[model samples]
Target: MMNIQKWLKHLSFASMAGMFLILVMGALVTKTESGRGCGDDWPLCNGKFVPAYTIESFIEYSHRFVVGVVGLILLATTIMVFLYSKRKDAKWYVGGAMLFTVLQAILGAMAVVWPQSSAVLALHFGFSLLSFAFTLLLYLVYTRFGGAMNKGDGTRLTSGVRWAVWGVLIYSYVVVYLGAFVRHTEAVGGCIGWPLCNGQVIPEMAGGTAIVFIHRVAAALLGLSILTLFLFIRAQASRDSAVYQAALYSLILVTLQILSGGFVTLAIGYDIYLLASLLHAMLVSFLFGVLCYLGIASVQTAERSSAKAYAASRLP
Candidate 1:
């Protein structure tokens, strides 16, 4: 018989992978302008359970089908974790993952059926990202509890390191929202130049140009924040391999994302932007996963610190 713990861990990883694919497919659907491919159909393509043979229709419909399948997988994983895991932490993570997945699906359907403004559609990406993060946390909990867990020598975090982690995580989410806003507003190519919109260091703050400019500014800030985070981790917390490695991975992904964002603008001018945009979206999803992992690690570190402090007090 397969061990239930091992099975649950695998299930958690599977759910996270599925969520990542859903995010990528969603980017494809939007980049290809497939949002209207089904002609306002909700839960069906062009009023049919099986969509017809059209490129846009197939892309959008397939994304919906994949999302549906992933939702079921997440629900099942949540139930199994809740039933079998001994840790209350595991239960909470699984429950949160299930809730976020459900909310994401509802928002996705509403985006299709309702007259969603660009702002609302952008919010959809934010919801999807949150769902992805929760799934990642669930995976982390499963591994930490089910496998040979490593507690990282119980290193104490300095105030600066702690605040850096917290600040970068918060700022990363803001950058994510701005990226989604850029997509939902269809302003991906609104600015024809990188570092500057329209070859100017500062473009006129007017119309969609402002949205694109804001997103660029957020991207630059996010890149700097991640870089600073990595440097801090290397200098102060290098002994904590897990934390240091997570910070390094996040830094690399964020850098790649920034490069892809610029390439997307340039490629779109050459009419090859769709693929670049898809890659850009995939990087953001992966970055979200890494950030979520870091968040979980931070929490565990804090709990360990609290326990040590309490024990030291009792010794007195």
Candidate 2:
């Protein structure tokens, strides 16, 4: 039984890493304009089992292959969780991964066979991000075992702090989607500068410029929101607590995310922008995952506190 559990842990970690790869490769496909590299084909690249020799076809086909393989691993991990694990939240994480994995694949297929609008294309990335987040959360669950709640050396979070954590998590997803929209719409050029749009605090709200500007404002707010949440969590929880550490990771990632946004702007019109773009996507993916774990830690801490209080009241 112990060996089986250990194997499950390894499998979950692999699935998590594979999902991360998919996210990076998906971003690569978009940045290189390789979405149509397979020429409107699904499951097969350019109507062949293996695509012809072309950079675009290779990227597109590789992404498809990785998604298919990782998806199967995720499915196996989910089935094992149901068969062997007893945690209720474990199911939620794996279930989310399965659901969004399917949705992301369908969206990718539709984009190829039907050529979706930019808004729809942006959703493809959002779905992929969610899938990656769930897989990451599942890995965290397996590695931590009895859950981070068991290490409750920290103080329970206030209702306000809990709300703030959940709120920021949801808002960060919105900011990510806006960033995806900017990519799909090719609106990066509209801004032309980081921390400023066309050399102004507020540029003309029209066309691609408007889209980029909105994403910028949204991202800036997300940074501020995360910073506020981190400080609040630190004040309430011990520095060594899971909740506090998660918040600290969140703060660091958001800071890097903001800096990467600036780096991307500076690298614009240069080939280096591709690397910068990938860095941006990678940071956001981890940031979202960390925030999800933080939410879980917050709820678990609250539940632990309530259990203790109830037990105390029952003491005679």
Candidate 3:
């Protein structure tokens, strides 16, 4: 029989991986414009239990099928975490993962049944991102509680680095949402040229082009912020290698994200662009998870420092 710890470990990993794949498949559904493949009938394809085997129906149904399976995995993970992890933080993180997963699933279903505005539909993707990030963190917290990974040195983050990590994280979400909005609104082709829209930095600020241009600008600022975060973490590399490595990983993801964005532009509306777009989604998701982990580490360090100072004060 598998030990409970081992069972939970495998479950957590499976849940996280499943969520990540769901994220990518969701992107595929959007890029392929297969949302309506089931023809306004959800949980069933066109009023039938089985889909008719058309390309659109197959993509859409496959996505739904995957979501159903992942949902079960998430349910199991949540139950196991509460059963095994008595830590307050562990419970909260796992609970949040379960909550957002359900919320995202509901939002996706609503859009399928009732055509929503672009803004509302865009939010559906945002929730998917949140669900995935939280689930990944759930796995991390689970591992830490089990004493599986090496606990990093007790190094407190300077206020500057701590704030930088958080700032970049929240800003990344805004940039991600903007990108989703571009896709939902069919504004991806608004900027015809790579980097610059229509060979102009400012492309008249009219129609879908304006939306695309603004997302590009926001993304540029996001890149700069992550670079600043990386520098701050690197400045204290000797103190805590763990935080530094997390920052380095964030840097790599953001760089790949930017490159993928450019490729997405060039390959817009083509089957090849689908791969680039999926990469873009996955990079941002993992980047957000890393930033969250760094933030949590900083808090843990601060708490430890406070305890040490209190003990020393009492020593006198």
Candidate 4:
């Protein structure tokens, strides 16, 4: 049983890492404009299992290959999680990962089969990000709880803090979507400056400029919201609590994300922009995953408190 548990832990960690790799590779494909490199082919590159050599085709096909391989790993991990995990929430994490993985794949196939609008393309990235988050949540749960039904630390956060954390989580996703929209719409060049959009407090809300500016504003708000959440959680939770740590990581990632955005802006015309953009995507993906874990931890803490209260009331 101990061996099995160790194996499951390793597998889950691998799946989580693979999922993040897919996110980064997907961003790479988009940044390089290699989505159609296979000439509208799916499951095959230009009617061949092995695509001809070209930088664009190689990148697009490589992304597809990693997706297929990691997808199978995810399937195996999901099955093992359900079979071994004694907790309901553990199963839910794996199940959510499976669901989002399939959804993202379907959306990805559709994009390849037919040219999609920028909005639809952005949804593809959103789905992938969610799938990554679910996988990460699954891994974190397994490592923390060992797939057992252990009661969590009964540290109850204030209702206000709970709501604030959840609210920030939801808003962060909106900011993520807006960022994807800016990328898909090729609006990165519209902003033209860091900390300012087109050299003004407000740029003309026309064309790509508007899209980029809106995303900038949303991202800024997300940073402020995360900072507030970290402070609130710190006030409520101990240094060792899972939610406290998750909130800390989220705050750190958002700060780096903002700085990475500036790096991307400065690298706009340089070869390094591609790397900068991928780093930006990677930070946002991890930030979302940490936020999801924080939400789960908060709920567990609340449940533990509720259970304690009920038991106290029943004491004779």
* Candidate lDDT (C-alpha), each: 0.79, 0.89, 0.81, 0.86
lDDT of 2 at 77: 93
Give lDDT for model 1: 0.79
Model 2, 83-133: lDDT tens digits are: 897767778888999999999999999999996999999999999999988
For model 4, residues 71-149, the per-residue Cα lDDT tens digits are 9999999888888867677688778888988898889888998989999999988989998988787777667642222
Off by over 4 Å in 4: 145-150
lDDT string for model 3 (1-316, tens) is 2587677778878988988988899988998899999998877899998978898999999999999999899888888888876556657777887888889889988998998999998888888888787777777765642221224456666777777777778888899899999989999889997877899978899999899999989988888888987887777755335677677888888888888889989987677888888888888788877877776766665566678889999995
Q: Which stretches of candidate 3 lie over 4 Å from their true place?
A: 142-152
- Taking the tens digit of each residue's C-alpha lDDT, what string does model 1 give over 30-97? 77888888888888889999978899998988988999999899888888887887767667777777
Candidate 4 or 3, higher lDDT: 4
CA lDDT, candidate 1, residue 161: 76
Name the candidate that leads on lDDT. 2
Candidate 1: worst 10 consecutive residues by lDDT? 144-153
Ranking by lDDT: 2, 4, 3, 1
TM-score of model number 3: 0.93
2 or 3, greater by lDDT: 2
With a 3 Å backbone cut-off (N, CA, C), the pairs that clash in candidate 2 are none
